[model samples]
Target: MAELMEQSLLAMREGAQATRDTGAACDRIGSAFDDMRSAAERLVDTAAEISTFVAAIDALAQQTNLLALNATIEAARAGEAGRGFSVVATEVKALSTQTRKVTDDIRQHISGLQAHVTALVETANGVGARLDDSRNATERANRHIQDVEGAVERNTASMDMIAGLIAGQKDATVKLEEGIASTLTHVSASEIFANEVVGAVSATDSVVKAQFASLEAFEIKNYVLHRAKSDHTLWKKRLAGMMAGLEGLRVDELVDHHSCRLGKWYDHVADPVLRNHPDFRALVKPHEEVHVRGREAAKRYADGDLVAARAAFEAMNVASTEVLMRLDRLIAAFQ
Candidate 1:
C-alpha cells in the first residue's frame, strides 16, 4: 500500500509539471502575438504617411502635366522657336506620367498590406480564444487532482486529455509564428515600393520646374484655366460669402472680394460668344441678366438702399432656378 501511494504521488507531480509547461507555452505565444500586432500598427502608420506624401506628389504632377500641355500647344503656335520648348515639355509630361504610375503602384500595394494585416489580427484573436480554452482545461485538470486523492481510471483519462491539448497547442503556436512571419515579409516589400515612389517624386522636381519657368504669362493663363474647371463647391462658397454681406445689407466687405469675383465672371468668363445653338444662348441669358441685377443690388446696399437691394436678391433667387435647369440639361447629357 505504501509503494502504491508513492507511485500515485509521483504521477500527480508529473501531471503538475506538464500543466506548467503548457501554461508557459501559452505565455510565449501571447507575447509573440503582441509583438506582431505592434508591427502591423507601425505598418499602418507608415502607409498613412506614404498616402499623404503621394497626394502632394499627385498635385505637383497634375500641375506639371497641365503646364507641359500648354507648352506643347504654344510650341505648335510658335511655328519655329517653340520646337525646343516642345521637346522639353514632352519629356516633362512623360515624367509626370511615370510618377503617376509609381504612386498608383504604391497605393495598390499598401492597400493589399492593410488587408493582410487585418487577417493577421483575426488570426491573433483566434489564437487568444484557443489559449483561453487551454488555460481552462489546465485549471480543470488541477482541480480534479485536488478533489480526489487517487483514482486511477478517471484521473488517467483526464491526464490523457490534457496531454492532447498541450500537443495541439504546440502545433497552433508553430502556425501562428509562420503566419506572422509571412505577413511581415509582405509588409517589408510594400515599404520598399513606397520608398521607390518617394525617390521618383524627388527626381521629377528639376524637369517640372524648368518646364514651368519657361512659360510666359499667356501660357500661365492656360494653367489657370486648367485649374479653374467648373467646381460648384467653390462657386457655392463665393456666393455664400456674397450673400452673407447682402443678407445683412453690409456691402463694405463685398465690394473688394465677392463682388469683384462676380464682376470678373461677368466680364470675362460669361462673355456672350457665338453659341452652337440659339436655344443655348436663350437658356443662359436669364442667368446673365440676374447676375447683372445682383451686382446692381450690391451697389444699392453700399448706397444704403436696403429695400431695393433685398428686392434684387429675391429676383436673383428666381433666376437661379433658370440657371439650375440649364445645368440639369448639361448634367443629363454628360451622364
Candidate 2:
C-alpha cells in the first residue's frame, strides 16, 4: 500500500512534468501558426495591391477605348483623306477592347486568390486560438496534479508516523511477554499493557484501513483507464459538435496521452516486474496511437477536411479499443 502511494505520487509528478512539456510545445506551435497567419495576411495584402494595379490598368484601357472612339469619329469626318488614320484608330479600339477583357479576367482571378488567402488566415487564427486554450487547460491540470502530489506526500508522512508507533507498541509488547510470569505485580502491569497494546493495534488497523480506503478511492488502474476512454469519447463528441456548427468547442481541449491519468500511471509504474509485463508494454503503443489519431481527426475537421477527419476518427476508435483491451489485461495482471 505504501509502495502504491509512492508510485501514485511519482506518477502525478511525472504527469505534471508532461503537462509542462506539452505547454511548451503548444507555445511553439502557436508561434508557428502566428507566423503562418501573418504570412497569409501579407499575401492577402499583396493580392489586394495586385487587384488595385489591375483596376488602374482596366481604367486606362477604358480611357484608351474612349480616345480611340473619338479618333475613329474624327477620321470618318475626314473621309477618304483620313482612311489610313481610320484603320489605325479601328485597330487601337480593338486592342483596347482586348485589354479590358484581359484585365477583367485578371481581376476575377485575383479576387478568387484573395478569398482563399483570407480563409487560410482565418483557419490559422482558429488553430492558434485552440492551441492557446489547450495550453491553458494543460497548465490548470498540471497545477491540480501538483496539489494531488502534495496531498499524497502529507498522507505518506502520516502513514510513516503511524507505522513507527505500531513498531514501538510491538517492541513494548515483546518485553512485557518476556517477564509475564516473573511476579503478580508484573502480571497486573502486563494486563494493563496488553490492554494498551490492543487499543494501539485497533488504532493502527483503523489507520491502515483508512489509508487503503483512500488509495482504493483513487480506483487506480480501472478507474484511470475508464476515465481516459471517457475523455476520448467526450473529445470526439465535442469535435463533432464543432463540425455541426456548435459553439464553444475547441479541438485544443483534447489532451495528449502523457497528460492523461492512464498515461501518468503507465509512465511511473514503479513495480519493475509489472512494468515489464507484456500487456503493460503493449499498451503504450496503442494508447499513444489513440491520442495521435484523435488529434489528427480534430485537426482534419478543423481544416474542413471532413472525409479525412472521419477516417482519422475511425482510426482513433480502433486504437482506443486496443488501448482498453490492453489496459484490461494489465489490470487483470495487477489483480
Candidate 3:
C-alpha cells in the first residue's frame, strides 16, 4: 500500500510541473501580444504623421498654383511690354502643375501605405487571436512603424528644400520689379530734356527776329561814319602801346601772341552772327590795321583794355533766349 501511495505522489508532481510549463508558455505569448499591440499603435501614429505631411504638401501646392495664376494675370495686364514676363509666368505655371502632380502622387503613396499598414495590423490581430502569444509579430510591427517614421522625416526635409527655393524666387521677382522702375525713370528724364531743348530753340528764334528788326531801322551811313572814326582812334592808341611792348620781341612772337588774342575774342563773341558780321570780319583780317592795333594793345598794361576783355566775356553770359537765337542761326546755316 505504501508503494502505491509513493507512485501517486510522483504522478501528482509530474502533473504540477506540466501545468507550470503551460503557464510560462502562456505568459510569453501574452507578452508578445502586448508588444504587437504597442507596435500597431506606433504604426497608426506614423500613418497619422504621414497624413499631416501630405496635407501640408497639398496646401503648399495650392499656394504655388495661386501664385502662378497671379503671375499670369499680371503678365496679361502688362500688354506687349510684359512678353518676357508672360513667358516666365507660363514656365511657373508649368512648375506649379508639376508640383501639384508630385504632391498628389505623394498623397496617394501615403494613403496606400496607411491602407497597407491597416491591413497588416488587422492580420496581426488575427494571428494574435489564433496564437498563444504575439511577441514576434509585435516586434515586426514595431519595425514597420520605424520605417514609416523614416519616410516621414525624408518627406519633411524635401518640403523644407522646396520652401527655400520658393523664397529665392520671390527675391528674384523683387529685383526685376526694381529694374522696371529704373527704366521708367530714365525714359521720363529723356522726355523732359527733349521738351526743354524744344523750348530753348523756340525762344532763340524769337530773339534773332527782334535783333534783325532793330538792325533794319538803323541809319547805315551815320552808323558807319561814327563806328569807323571811333575804331580808328581806338586802334591808333592800341597799336602804339603794342609796338612799344614789342621793342625786344621778335615778329614771330608777336604774331603768335596776336593769334591767341584773336582766338580769345572769337570765344568771347557767343553770337555767331555778331562775330561773323561784315564790319567785325573786316577788322580781324591778317595785315589789317585793326588786327595790328589789337596785337600792339596786348603788349601794353592798359586798364581800359583789361576792362574791355572782361566786358566782352560778361556780354556772352546772356539770357537763354539770346544765346539760343545765335546758336539757331549757326545750326541752320550749317544744315
**Candidate that beats the other on lDDT, 1 or 2, i.e. the better one:** 2
**CA shift at 272, candidate 1, in angstroms?**
99
Instruction: Give all candidates' CA lDDT scores.
Output: 0.64, 0.80, 0.56
lDDT of 2 at 331: 64
> Per-residue alpha-carbon lDDT of model 1 for 16-53, expressed as tens digits?
77877877787788788778877877877887788889
What digit string (tens of lDDT, one per residue) describes model 3 on residues 96-185? 788778878887887888788788788777766755434444445445555655555555566667777877899898999999999999
Worst 10 residues of 3 by lDDT: 312-321
Clashing pairs in 1: none
Candidate 3's C-alpha runs over 4 A off are 1-12, 127-335
- Give me the runs in candidate 2 sitting further than 4 Å from their true place: 167-335
Ranked by TM-score, the better of candidates 1 and 3 is 1
- Model 1 / residue 69 / CA error / Å: 1.1
Tens digits of per-residue lDDT, candidate 2, 23-56, equal 8999899899999999999999999999999999
